[model samples]
Target: MIDTATAPGSGGAPPAAPTRAGRRPATTSGPLRREYIWLALLLVGTGAAYLWNLTASGWANSFYAAAVQSGAKSWKAFFFGSSDWANAITVDKTPASLWPMELSARLFGFGSWTMLLPQVLLGVASVALLWAVVRRHFGANAGLLAGLALAVTPVAALMFRYNNPDALLVFLMIAAVWTMLRALDDGRWRWLVLCGLLVGFGFLAKQLQAGLVLPALALTYLFAGPPKLGKRIAQLFAAGAAMVAGAGWWVLVAQLWPASDRPYFGGSTNNSIIELTLGYNGLDRLGLGSGSGKPGGGGAPGGDPGGGVTAGVDLAAGGDMPQMHGGFHPFGGQAGITRLFNETVGGQIAWLIPAALILLVAAIILRGRAPRTDGKRAALLLLGGWGLVTGLVFSFMGGIFHEYYTVALAPALAGTIGAAGAVVWAERERRWVRAVLVLSVALTALTAFVLLSRTPDFVPWLRWLIVGVAVLAAAGLVLRGGRRLTIATLLAAVFVGLAAPTAYAVETLRQPHTGGIVKAGPATDSGFPGFPGGNRDAQSDPESGAAAPGGDAPGGATDAGGDADRERAGGGGPMGDEKPGDEVLALLEQDGSAYTWVAATISSNNAASYQLAADYPVMAIGGFGGGDPAPTLAQFQRDVTEGKIHYFIAGENHGPGGSSTSEGSKITAWVKDHYTATEVDGVTLYDLTATPKAG
Candidate 1:
């Protein structure tokens, strides 16, 4: 967050002086020990707040779900942190954005849960970046305020705890921008190289989202600067190299892989690697999903379809969204080129989540507007744009829209929100306004804790008291200043107050088996992410609980143009109540070799029966006709003569992602005679797997 006045124009124009500083230097000197101290306090406070969410509740986000599914398919990939997540297991075309965790896993073998740590780790990094950016642009107080704001933001809180690419994306993007600014300012070639490398790697973490944030920020600065031409070009080129290093490896590999190996959807054609790669990650300015908007997440500019129905209706009738003209997107041009920002960044999130963001944004606009010359202002523009761009592009994903998608834009937004908190300090005169500032930060912190306190073990009353202390601590900051005694007391009070709630959260996570989520990769193909402390009791609640067996997906069933019945899904898992320890229930939650049967099977694995029947919703592949694979050649002939096995599945197992693996010629014969293929995912369904037997 460099102030423009101190930062030389990328276009070579000098920035305007601040109204408050009559003789502010073009370049400001620096802070002493206090700088690190306040930032450290900020870090400790934020860490305490988010640590509570470590095991608060729910499942791993879709990105991690895709990763964990991939992990299960190939242990080698899982162990080596493989990049082979090309739609073999999960539904998404490519989870290329999961490079960092894969790389970490390949290097470390702590299991899937380690992946979740990356989000928190990156969140910590984002706070650090905020501190650094704010320190450079504003002062320690402003930096501290920025850190405090980010710590409590609902979105920031979610991204920090949830397993997704956004948190990591935010960290890397900020790191890249911060480094790039440094590189350009001092003409340090090494920093530029670091910038390039960071950009490239961040690009890998969340596709082009991170890579573009830096350039976008730079170019935005250029908007403020008249044209310097040559210098701007050189700075961009140096930064470009950083992006290439981190993300370029994937491009080369995607090119070399055979076309058949890469059955990507979206706008990617298996032409050459470059075309596939670009369309996969770069194009679509507004596309959603890993490969989709990396084609069309952009919607019509200023198009606010009030709620999803209005958006869907507009897409259907307004000629505004893609219409099915000849079964294709009719609005397939530039309007379609960039996905709507309103949808991606502004649209998604819990209704309250958006409400909170609106509140923060409004607060900044009305009460907390920082000096225009402040570098924090520049940082805000950059981070704000980053969140807006990713949020807008990813929200329109036709298929999966997990909570982590919000992570992509979170870093920029978090730090900016924190800066907004500091804007409260800008009001030097009004005592009441400053009191409001203290109250706002405290309220924000309290709200975040309440929303995050969904875990069963945590006592709601205790959490409220912890929040009360944090509010008091925040109030202390205004009345005190740089006095060694007040600052130290204030710092300790603020941190401990925040830590109490957070500490309770972490302790609650220690108990395993509580209903929770894991990042298991695509079904059967691969899988896993996260630690194993859970308290999941996947049983029917006596009090208006879901079905005794697992119910349908909470976010709704993901039907990527396939046969899936939500009614059948609610009953997936054990037919009888889930026992104290149920592996099938666990497996059911993950993406794995899932096959559904309406009737029964020869296998005596009771858990399997309940698991398959209750957790997964696809129709059965056996016993519908004469028998799966047709009972025997003679039986098959009799059944065929009798017209049995109306539907069935055959062919090789194709490893994980292949067609149905159920075998035996008699099995195949019986299946065909008695059953008909119903609908399939990687599994085959039969209209009949068993004969009527004249019953």
Candidate 2:
């Protein structure tokens, strides 16, 4: 057990004298110097990796980027996370994740660097916090290793450098765990309350996904908290109250504000935040209900098809939806036990998962007889439960899954490996423990081989190198001799376990990713068969301006280029990557201040492109997938009659799979009936202010 092996002075050394606080005195200068040096190196390395070439993504997910832009322009938009300064409709989720970027953009002036820099800082802080948490129980070496593991996770590296909610969500989750563990150590009410507050803020970042850690937190405290039964129950109630307060204030404001004055609660059919939480962001995410409130209206893959306009296409001919770049499977490759290991997802966060699971079991069995309040066992329970619960939900959940969502698993896996590895190493003198260590390394190496084989052409030799090193390390562990030999063998094992993921992380950093859905590592056959390259842009017909069916386009176009060129060269369609042409931008900017909105579009993705370029509010008829009824046709007609909206840009109106006679389709039909179309460079626009022609 860890208690017997790692006890102070248990390894034939004199016990350190206790200070007035009943804690051991500080270690000698030599050991202290090395620990601080390693800590410094870990933090510096993480910051450098996350910050390298941060601007290459250039408004990464322009959907969020456009919202950040709106928030920077108007305080109302900032508070509501509206898609435009005019506050026609808010983005699909809560505004907490956008708050930091909005504040930064307001202070530094909005640009790619200003928008993304906050995310990078958050990623680095997560690494440092993970190290501190592990070091509090395990040794310094274990802490450094955990930090390194998290930093090199491919998905972690990708999301940290991009402007997405996952970065803030992950940071808040880790901080909550840290505080929960501190409470376990002392049975303090304040720490538990702080932990609740952190989780509540996490809810504001990504909704229900933040609550995945709640079970582990509550169970850990109940079993391992220093307080007696009655006090522990009382404290949990207090923590629950704090959590409600932390997350409820915003919900109250959004619900209590006069419906006519504030932005509509986006992603909700009834314009209610409560519905948005329990329906769209909650049950719909779990595949329990249609996210858009209509029957079968969720954004599931290959669902019902709806009609919409595309560049160079007529309103009657339902245009082809934009395809995912590289033919990557968007649902994380079907719901089941092996989902995480699928080609589309395995390369991101699955590299260390096998080892983490093995070590978690070993740590649990070794600590089985420890006392009820043992901190080491408590930490393992917290981390292991977190990884298991979150991983299973990710694997089997049938709705709206992305490969990058695996980033949530990074911190828990890293902490488990660090804590368990320390325990197994302390008992290395036992032959069975050494054998378990060898088996864990072999399994990890085998996993690396399979994942590496999927991307054979990318670092082809690395997989074989890992297998060879793993074998050598196993033999060295079985027949150890000197201390130097043991150290060398341990180094080989580390290389075998970390080399593959680290390579993938480095590759992720090299490429510039821009899209609503992104993956880590080089392109491989892991994507759907027949989609084998990294290019994400759909090919468009030069003369007709319509995207070619099943054609590929250039990927990673910068915002500095001509807007029309960027649209043609990138995956700009319903995917939200499209930018306005020079002619359209000029047209929209002319006398734009006279109207509340320069233009309106059916989907947020389509509207985000023009809104970002025009620097004006362009009402998204429906939120996100064009399903929620933010503005009914009557509302839109009222705006047009009052000369509030200038133009109506014709663009895609359906969600991913497609919608079924949703409000977006209705608005599009009415717009076409009432106005004449004007083509500018390839985009279709209708001037809403002009008198309607005879039907």
The TM-score values for the models, in the order shown, are 0.52, 0.88
**Best prediction by TM-score:** 2
Residue 270 lDDT in candidate 1? 29
Instruction: Tell me the spans in candidate 2 whose CA falls farther than 4 Å from its real position.
Output: 1-25, 291-296, 300-330, 525-575, 653-660
**Candidate topping lDDT:** 2
Q: Please state the error at residue 522 of candidate 1 in Å.
A: 28
Per-residue error (Å), model 2, residue 499: 0.6
Off by over 4 Å in 1: 1-34, 48-59, 62-66, 69-100, 103-112, 187-193, 211-215, 221-228, 241-245, 259-377, 380-404, 417-567, 570-695
lDDT of 1 at 489: 34
lDDT agreement of model 2 with the native: 0.74
Instruction: Output the lDDT of residue 610, model 2.
Output: 76
Residue-level lDDT of model 2, residues 1-695, one tens digit each, is 43422533122222242232324566667766777788889889888987886665656677788889999999999988888889989887889999999999999998778988889889999998998777667767777788999999999999998777889999999999999878887788899899999999898898888998888998889889888989998898888888888888888998899989988777676888788788757775665654324322433211111111123422112233322222223447766789899888899999988889988888888888888987778989998899999999988775556788899999999988888887777777788888889999999999999999988889999999999999999998899878778778878988988999999999888766665656788744332211111133121111112111112123333233334443442222233544556688899899999999999886676677677777778887776656667687788889999999999877554433225466666777788898998877656788998999787
Show the lowest summed lDDT stretch of 10 residues, model 2. Answer: 540-549
| lDDT score for residue 422 of model 1 | 40
